[model samples]
Structure formats: C-alpha cells, structure tokens
Target: MNKTKNNFIYNIITKDLKKCKHKKIYTRFPPEPNGYLHIGHAKSILLNFNIAKKFNGICNLRLDDTNPSKENKKYVNSIKYDIKWLGFKFYYDIYYTSQYFYLLYKFSIKLIKNGLAYIDELNKHQISKYKGNFNNLGKNSPYRKRSINENLIFFKKMKNGFFNNGKISLRAKINMLSPNILMRDPILYRIKFNKHYKTKYIWCIYPMYDFAHCLSDYIEKITHSLCTLEFQDNKILYDWFLNNLKIFNKPKQYEFSRLNIEYNVISKRKLSILIKKKIITGWDDPRIVTLSGLRNRGYTSNSILNFCNSIGVTRQNSLIKISFLENFIRKELNIKSQRLIAVLNPIKIIIENFNKIKEKILIPNHPQNKNMGKRKYVFSKEIYIDNKDFKEKKTNGYRGLTIGNKVKLRYSYIIKAKKIKKDKNGNIIYILCKYYKNRKKNNVNGIIHWISKLYSIPAIFFLYYNLFKISNPENKKNFIKYINKKSLVINRGFIEKNIKNINNFSYQFERKGYFCLNKNFKNNNIFYFNRIVKLKNII
Candidate 1:
C-alpha cells in the first residue's frame, strides 16, 4: 500500500525520535484560512497528516486564522473541504488561533509583566523607520522607555478596543540590533476592527502570526512545526519566543521548500490579484490551483498523495516542471480510471452506397480489467471523427485520418474518405466515406476511437491547459503579465454510445485524458468533463 516504502526520511525520523525520547510525535499544518489552499498547501497537508498517520500520532488542522483582514468563513470552510478531500480526518478539536485570543491576550500580559514585551504607539510607517535594514541596527522606538505600568494599561485598553487600526502594536521586546528583521522587535499584536468569521466582532486586536503560531504549537504540545522554505528565516524568532517563555514542550520549527509548478501561481496575494484582474476566474476555477479546482477536474486524493510522496521532502528550493507532477497523476489514473471513447473535435463522415442493417459494437470497458465488463456501441452509416484525426495532406509523422486514406474505426471495419461537402464559406461541413467489407486490426496505417452517428452519446469536453503562461508563475515578480491566453479552451463534443452509462465520477476518454462529470449533468446527461491531463503525457 505504501508507494515510497522504506524511504530514508521515515527511518531518519524514527531514529531521531528514539534519541530525543519522544514517544509520540505531533505535527501540524497551520494555514492562515485567508485563501483557498493550493498545491503548496497540499504538500504541507500531506506531510503533516501522512507523517502523523505513519507514526501513529495526531496531526492538527489548525486554522492560523490570525489575520482577520484576509480571512473568511468561506475560506475556512473551503480549507476543511480540501483537507478532507485529500483524505484527512480531524476531530472537533479543530482549532483557530482566534479561539485562543483570550489565552493569547493573557500570555501577552505575562510577557509585559516580565518586561519581555511592550506596547509601542508607532504607526506602520514609524515602525518601519526604526526597523533598519538587517545589516544596520534598527533605531529604537521612543515608547521603548515607557514604564511597565503605563505600557500594561495601554495594552489593556488596546485589547479592550481603545486603539484605532494601525495606531499601535504589541512588539516583542527582543533585540532591535538583531540581524534578522523579523526578530528585530517583531510586532506581536495589531488592532483590526474587521469581523472574524469565527470570533465575530468580539475582539478588536488580533495576534500576529509569529506570536499566535508559536503559542498555538506550544499549547497543543506539537512536537514539530513543519513549514515551507519561506519561513526558514522566521525559525530564529520561533525559537526565541519559546526559549524565553520557557515553554516545557517547545516544538522545533523545521522548514522544507514549498513545491511549485510551472505555469502555476501558488501565492494567495497573486491568486487574489488574478481573480481581481479577471485574468482567471475565481479561486475554484479549474485553472486555479485550489483543491476544488483540481476536484472539479477529477484529481483524487490518492493520486495527489502518491504524487506528493514521489516528490519527497527536500531542503532545496526548486520549481518542478508541471509535466513532472502531471506525469504522476497520469500514471496512477491510467491504471485505475475506466477508459471510454470521446471525441473532442468532431467531423461527420457518412458512408455512401452501403445501406445495411443497424450494427452494434461491443467494446471492452477496460483493456486489462475485464471484471469491469463490456458495453455496446452503435455503428451507423454516418459517423463523426476528429478533424485533426483526418488530414488532406500528411504532416511529419501523420498516421491519422486523411483524404483518401483508409483508417480503421477501432473495433470496427475500415473506412476510406471518398468525398467532402462544403458550404458557401468553403469549409468541410462533412466528409463522405466508403467502408471496407472485411477489416481487421493493423490493416491500415491509422486506427482511431469513434462514436456511432445513430446512437451517439452527446458530451461536452472542456479541454484544460496549464494555469499560467510563464514557466515559473509563482515567482515573487509580477504575474499579471504572464496570463496564458489558452488556459481553458472549451469544446463540446460526443463519445461512443457505450460510454453513456459509464461512471461519470472518474473516467478517461480512451487515448484522450482523465476527466470528471461536471456539476451540471442533467437528464440528457449532457455533462461537462474537464480533462485532468492527457493520459500518456500526464504521467
């Protein structure tokens, strides 16, 4: 059942725990709940949950929901759905940093009385002025000299909603000369009047990430705080907070490089920008990296888990070619997904001078998996094939349908293109063909999957392309300039009659791709199927 069996990482983790005398290891994936979790989040999710499962421990799905400005109930709900879709189960103990607001507030009081923290009335601009470049010592805040009593009283009113937004912040009284800007008197709390989806408007001040995250891990007794490479620099601050607070079960922060894909944007801010600029649709648009987008496009959790395992954990920051990930999906789906015949680009061909009784074709549901059984398709005089399948002239490696070229209709007899009809616009509306009496496999240069004209299944094939145009769409640079104009090219077409009853949940249009039945499937079953990726190239 395990794909990456006996991997070194597992052995290493086991040995480390034994040395530390850590009986049970606890890990967590703390997303901010601000945006739909993307592929990067999927990596972190699998790392946390799968590692816990491997070691017979628990992994908490904590909503690092500290930033109220960018978070919402919708995003929180989406995060839950996505995590579950990826095959994770969490208890009612599911937590939000907001849930610990009072506890965090009390903790802040502890720091204040200990002189480890003080409230500074420096607005953002004033704070930045004192926060010198890492090489230079940050100028101290004027309020740094405020007496403990005055600072505590002001902090209480700030907690009680006395401070306007951005007026003041609770800064950890760390070294202002620290080389790391994040540790150079990092802001622990800020005043925001926004309504939290979970806490509502009860609290005016929210704990900043560095403050709430470390405390949350400590409170939950998390053994390890797994994060992406972006937080590697913040490890110092994480350690300082724990060491100074003298937390008994201080969890260590370990960072791994976040997985990035070519032609994909994983940043929440950039994703929001894409939506706002109308470069793409909403977060769940199939083109987006959100789990909902992948779900809509027919990617299963098993496939995703397998894909993540194949990549493994690494310290190096690298952007993997999208092809590598897509390839993994294709490999798994090809073996499991049932195959059907669906034509995305249709061109009708009518057999002339050969009138015969209605013919039915029995096609194997799956080539190797016979328990899946077979289904019947119809054979009629007039059938539509792909236009690209046929060519009036041959390309470099042409073997598909072409003018006067005889091609087998896959599981049926051979047909030769005879004549074509065009409207006033001079476009081939349809092609006329003649059928060979005794056709067998390998009798011709080309054989293609096709649906019968008389008993065809009407389907919509929504072909998908990569989400972005640039190879590294997740780079810190601007992404608006790299919109892939052809990200989603919608095509409505038909498949063989036998495919009509096939389970729409997961299917592969034989020699085409993996796809899912769209939500709008109706009585006619005029469903939409978004191609997960081409079966061959994807894996």
Candidate 2:
C-alpha cells in the first residue's frame, strides 16, 4: 500500500481508533448509477478504499440506485468496472439502495406513525416556492397539519401506486421555517412509474436520495460516510434522517473537496447533453475526463491513483489545472513506454549517396533503461521525416535540415540536404540528401526521427486537445458554444513496422507525443493510434 499522507479525515479516523469509538471503521463509495464514472468519482473511490486499507477496515461499494428514471444496469456495471480498474476491491457483495426498499419504506412509516412526517400534494414548482430561498423563511404546506392516520393512509396509497407520478409526495414533517432550506420539509418519497433496473415495477414510489442515503448507511453499518464538499449543507439533512429514526451506530458524514479540473465538465447532465448533441462521441471520448475515457486514451490506473493522492483530501473547493493531472501520466509513460519513430506530416527524404538498398539500425526502446532492450529498424535509401522538421530557407538557429546544414537521423548516420523537389503549386514535396557512411559523431544541426519508406507502416493518428475553448465552460450560459471544434485532429502517418506486434504498450513516438493503439483498432492494413499526452507539458 502506498503511504497516505495524514489529512484531517485521516486524523479523525486515527482518533476514533485510539479512543475505541468503534472496533473497526467502515467506509463506502455510493454513486448514483446514472452515468459513467468521472475523475471526480476517482478521488472518492481512492479515499474510501485507501482509508480501509490503511486502518485494516472495510469499504463497501454501494449503488445509490434510488432514481429509476435515469438508473440502469449498464451504468452499474460500468461503476463496478471503474472501481476495479482503479485497483480497489469492495469488502463483499455490492450493495444497492434498492435492496433496502422494504426497510426504508418501514422507516418512513415509523416517522409517519410518530407524527414526524406528512404527505404533501404540492407539485414540483409549488414545492420549490414553498421551500423558499436563503433570504426568506419557507411556509409550511397545507397538509402539514394532516392527522397521523390520514398521513399513513395517503402514504400507503402512494406506495400502492394510487397516486400518479408527482401527484403526492411523502415529506419529513421537519421545520418549514428552519434556516436550512433542505431541512424545510424535504421529500421522503416520490412516485416514479419508470421501471427500475433491479426492482422493476415492484416499486412505484422510491425513496429520495436524502431519505435513502442515511438509512442505507445505517442498515449497512457504515461507520464514516465520506462525501464531497457540495454535500456540506446536505450533511444536516443526512444526520436528521439518521437521528430522527433514532438508529444506533449511525454513520458520521465527512466532506472533502471534489476534484474539479479546468476545461472539463463532470456533471452527468451536461455530459449527457454533450452526447445528445454529438458534441462528443460518447463518455469514452478521448477528450473527455471520464475514467473510461482516460483509460481509452492510454492512462494507467497507477497514474490516476498517484494524481489523486498528490492532491490529498481537503474541504475547500478549487479548480485544478489540467496539466497537474497530465503530468502524472507524462512522467509515468516516460519511464515505462517504449520509444518508436513516426512521421505524421510525411515529407520524403531520398539518400542519393547511400550504397546499399537497405541497412539495419538498432535503437534503444528507452534512453535511460538498458534492460528495456532495443528494436531494429530498416535504414533504407528512401525515408520520410516530419515536414515540420525541415526548412527550405533556414532561419537563425534553425536546427533542422536546410540547404547548407547537416542533420542527424535518429539511430542512423548523418545526412545533409542537397536539393529539394516541389509540386506544381510550389510546395516542397520531398528533399534529396547524401548520407555519411562513418559511424562517427558529426556537428549536426539537430537529430530528427524518420521511418524507412520500405518498412514504414501506414497508420492514422488522433491528436486530442481540450474539449472546451475556455478554462471553465460551465460558467457560460451555453457551455456547448465554447466547445473546441479542433479538439480532435486526425493525421495520416507512418510508424515503424515493428510496432505491429507491440500494440499493448504505449510508445513515445520519438519527437512526437506519447501514443497507444486505439481501443477500436482492428485493421491490419492501417493502424490507429491515439495521442495520450505530449512529450512534455504544453500550455
């Protein structure tokens, strides 16, 4: 286990252990199965599971599948996959809030029989108006004075599907004038006719998140319910549900700042809109920050975990620069990824003075690690280099190929530019060069990567940029308007032939950025590679 830094939550857990507040600690990651997990979800997963591992406790994976209207089995499976992909194992069988529907319904009944709850006939808009804002106190509903027997009969009718969807809602008869708006008669149960993925139509009325969350925690015996800072206000209602029920061993709620990366949106609603409008391919689009998307873009689980740990746990919300997350993967791939030569903007280079048709050259897979071994490539009479690496008219300090200067081809002999050929439009189509035979170092302008025309493999490269043009797209009234049109740029390229057998590993494409085989790659004639990150951090 990696050593976790002692944060405020860690200190609290330690004190609880020392004081024997509980024999063991329990933590859970409860996610609504409405969409794919994002990087923000990763922070919670690591914190909960890591805390369990640190103190010899247990962490459970609980699916808050209370909202059947948007929940499904596919998202549940995805949530499980993401957690496991992040290298975490839940304590035992996965738990679902739907599993405790009976208990939760009975708990609501207990509240109603004790005269602590009542039924409200207010519509959605009316509920909002009565809830009031922070500036003004809310007014109690007309039904708040309903007799206990009347409330129970109406609640039973709601459970029996006698009430149409949104006709009537069972609410906790808390304070309507309370300062905390959430506590001002929050909805306990609502009628939803949508079929649940797990329970199907057996449940017409489902418990609200606030009602099911704390009760589910108590039933599961969760000791510490860790959540994001946005729930700091909801903590009051979270406790209210547990406290009113008078349940022993009630889990305490703790909040930490959620991971918010600039230029990204983790909100499920916004993400769904992006998909609906085809702003992105899907949740796994390489430009997205969703866990599946990051994994598809060649991010390793270790790099993500390290990034989460580096940020640590805190209560204050702040926007993290996207480079901070990119740096972790960049550093990890630097040591682990193999080096391969590729030319995205191919400009042909013909070595006129070369004696042999082709010769073999060996290049180390990694510069600093000899044990990573080397791969052989064909240095032929004709080769291709990136167009950006040459200049017809040399500027000051130009290090690439020019009329009078020599440049070194990586893992090959030095070559000097002698002449160039142009197309009908006066564009340089290719360059003619003469190669030196001696394996001796020469004063070359710069070293450049190339692939032999005879041995080069045709491939397509997908270069991804930030999906949003601005740092914070959510600030705009219409975030979609700020979507970067050039987020994905495709380039036809050539990679070394040897890369065919090494599809599983990420590679640094020599001077180009790090890349990995696209998850959708299948054709042998043309390979597809996705650019993971740049060779270095670029603003």
Candidate 3:
C-alpha cells in the first residue's frame, strides 16, 4: 500500500473511522463493461483503491454488468487489464453483478411481497408520461394498486420470459408526486431478450442499474460507494432500495466531481461513435485520453497517477486544461527519459576540413543525471541536421546555421557554414561547413542536434495533436465536424544507431520532443516512433 494523501474523501473516511462506524473500510470500483476505461475512470480507480489502502481496508473490482446488451467480455477483460496496469489489487477474485443475479432476484421478490414494488404494464413512453417532469406531479400507474400476490405473480411471469421486451416492467412503489423525479416509481427490472455475455440465455429479465448497484455493494459489504456528481440525484434512489429492503450491511454512496478535460470527449457513447465511424483507429488511438491510448502513447502509469492526485477530490465541477496533464508527463520524462539526438527533416552537413574518416563521440544519456551513464556514437564527415536549423538568408535573432555564421553541434565541435549546394528547385540539398576543435561552448551562435548520416537509423514518427480543433467541442451540435484533420501527422526521422534497449526506454529526441517506440510495430524491420510530448508545453 502506498502512503495515502489527504483529501476531501480521505477526511470523510477519517471521521468515519474515529466514530467507529465500522471496524474496517470497504470500497469498490464498479464500471460497466461497455467501453475501454478513460482518464476520468482513472480518477475513480485511484480514489477508491487508495482510500481502502490508506485505512488498511480492501477495495473490490466489480463489473456492473447489469445491461448486458451493451456489455461484453472484451470490455471486461480490458477493464481488468487497465486496473492492473494502474497498479491496484482487488480484495479477492473479480466480482460481477451477474454473479449476484440470483440474490438480486430474490430481493426483488421480497420487495413485491412487502408491497414496496409492483409490475407495471405501461410501455416505455407511457411510463415516461406518468413520471412527470419537475413542472408537474406524476400520476400513479393504474397497476400501482395491484395486490402483493397479484404483483408477485406478474413479476415471476415477467422473470420467466412470458412478457415481451418493454411490454411490462417491475417498478418500485414510491411516491409519484415526489419532487425528485427519479424516485417517482423508478423501474427495478425489465425484460431483455438479448443474450448476456456472461450468463448467456439463462434469464431474460435483467435488473436495472439503479436496482442492482446498491444491492451489489451491500452483498459485497462495501462501506463507501463513491461515484461521480451526476449520481447525486440518483443517491436518493440508491438509498431508497437499501432502506426498503432492510439490508443489515447497508453502504453509503458519496458523490465527487468527474474528471473532464478540455478539447476531449469523455463520454463512452461519443467515443463509440468515433470508433464506429473509423474516425480513430480504435479505443487505443493515441489522440484520445483512454487509458490504453495513453499507455500506447508512452505515458507512464506514475505520471497518470500523479496527475489524478494533483487534481484533488472535490464537489465543484470544472473543465481542466489538457496542458495541465501534459505537464506531469513532461516533468517525469525530463528526469527519467534518456536523451538521444534525432533529425526529423534531414539536411546534409559535410565537414570539408575533417581528415579522419570516422571518430567516436560520447554523450550523456541524461544531461542532469550523471549516474545514468553515457552512450557512444560514431561521428563522420557527413552528418544530417534538421533543415529548419539552417537558413540561406539569415533572419534577425536566428541562431541556427547560416552563411559565415558559426553554430555548435550538440556535444561536438563548433562549425561555420561556408557554402551551400541546391537542386534545380532552389532547395538546399546540403551545406559545406568547417569544424573547429577545442572551441569554447559560448563561441557558437547556437547549438543544434544532428545525426551521422552514415550510421543513423531510419524511423517513422507519429506526431499527435488534439482530436478536436476547438477547446470545447461538446457545445457544438455536430461535434464530428470539428474533428481536427491534423490530429495525427507522420514524419520520417533518424536517430543515433547505437541506442541499446530501445524498446524498453523513452527518449527525448534532442531538441525535437520526447518519443518512444510504437508498440504496434516493435518487432517489424522498420522502426516506428510515437511523439509522446514536445520538450515544451503547447496547447
């Protein structure tokens, strides 16, 4: 268990422990297995698991598989992998809402016998009409007056698949005139003929989320049911079920603001649409904020956890800038990632005065950390520098290579451009330069990163930008129209050849940016790199 940080949730747990409300604290992260986990889910995972660890309690991983029509084994497996990748351990074997279906069914029967619930024959539209909005009070369902025996028979028949989908539903017998619309006879269970991923065709009637969530927590003896603020209103329904059922080990639900980042869509429904339309490669597309996407894009688990912790648990909802999260990875990679020189747009620089065919130059893997050691690279007369680093016509304050101006090659000697060779299109093919050995570092106009043309390895780079052009696309009527066409740009680049253990480490590509080997093509002949982030922050 890691040292727990103080936060609003932590404060609540402390007060509970001091009051001896319970001997041990229990929490659970219950996600519907409908889509891949995203950054917003990361906040909840860390909060629930860490809260349990802080108090020497246990946190369980539960799949809220109530609506199997949208759930599947693929998502269940992905959820497990993500939670494990985030460095959390569930209390025992992974639990599922489907595992408690029998118990939940019995509880529903008890509610029918207790006259707290009834079977309604109204269709979906009629149910909505009866459950009026805040402007008017809801009218009681005609079937709300059915006897307990009659409601029990109808519920049992519905459970046995006698009723078609949406023909009949079991609704809790709550006040129809209550100002809280959700409590106005909410649906407890409905008929769904679709096959479930886990239970298959064993049953037809599945319990609704509001009916199963609180009971599942009670069955697992969960003490803290933490969810996002959207559930603040649903908390009443969550409590009503537990109270009416008279469950002994009742759990309390707590609401916290969700993690919403600027320029990104966090909703699962919208993400599914993006995938279905092939706008993204998949759930793991590097441009999105899904956990798998971030992992594939070279974001460390520590960096993500640090970001989640920095945004403390609170009740106030607000949008966070994406750059704020980028800063965490930037700071982390700055200290940990090795530095390697790479040239994105190679422009040849021929050392005319060099006599030696080739030589070895040693550069530190990390500038600040001496213990990280150094890497040796072959230096030749011919080298490749970024085309943007040189100019035929010198501009004001441009410190890069220019005619008659000296610039230092990083970790090497200072050189002055003498003349340039260009193609028929007036493009500078290469530049001729003279090198000066043992020159003072400050003597050069600027320093630039370069790769030996002879020994450099060719690699493809994928540069990622925000998926949406605007900061908040959620406000737009057609969010897809605002999709950024330049979200992903590909560039061919070269890196030092002697980079050992390349697959295991991320590298700061000298002055360009931090990059890592693309996991999709790790074993391929050609190397593929993903630009994790730039050296400096950009919106």
Q: Whose lDDT is greatest here?
A: 2
Q: What does candidate 2's lDDT look like per residue over 303-381, in tens digits?
A: 9999988888888888999999999999999988888888998999999988788998778888999998988889998
Return the TM-score for each candidate structure.
0.93, 0.95, 0.92
Checking candidate 3 for backbone clashes, the offending pairs are none
Deviation in Å, model 2, residue 434 alpha carbon: 3.1
Q: What are the per-residue Cα lDDT tens digits for candidate 3 across 235-351? A: 889888988888776898889998989889988889999999999999999999999999999998888999998888888998999989999999989988888888888899999
Please give the CA lDDT of all the candidate structures.
0.81, 0.90, 0.89
Candidate achieving higher TM-score, 2 or 3: 2
lDDT of 1 by residue, 89-208 (tens): 994478878878898998888888889898898899889989999567898898887888988999989988887999989999988888789978989999999988888999899998
Best by TM-score: 2
Model 1, residue 276: distance off in Å is 2.3
* Shift in Å, residue 240, candidate 1: 2.0
Weakest 10 consecutive residues of candidate 3 by summed lDDT: 1-10
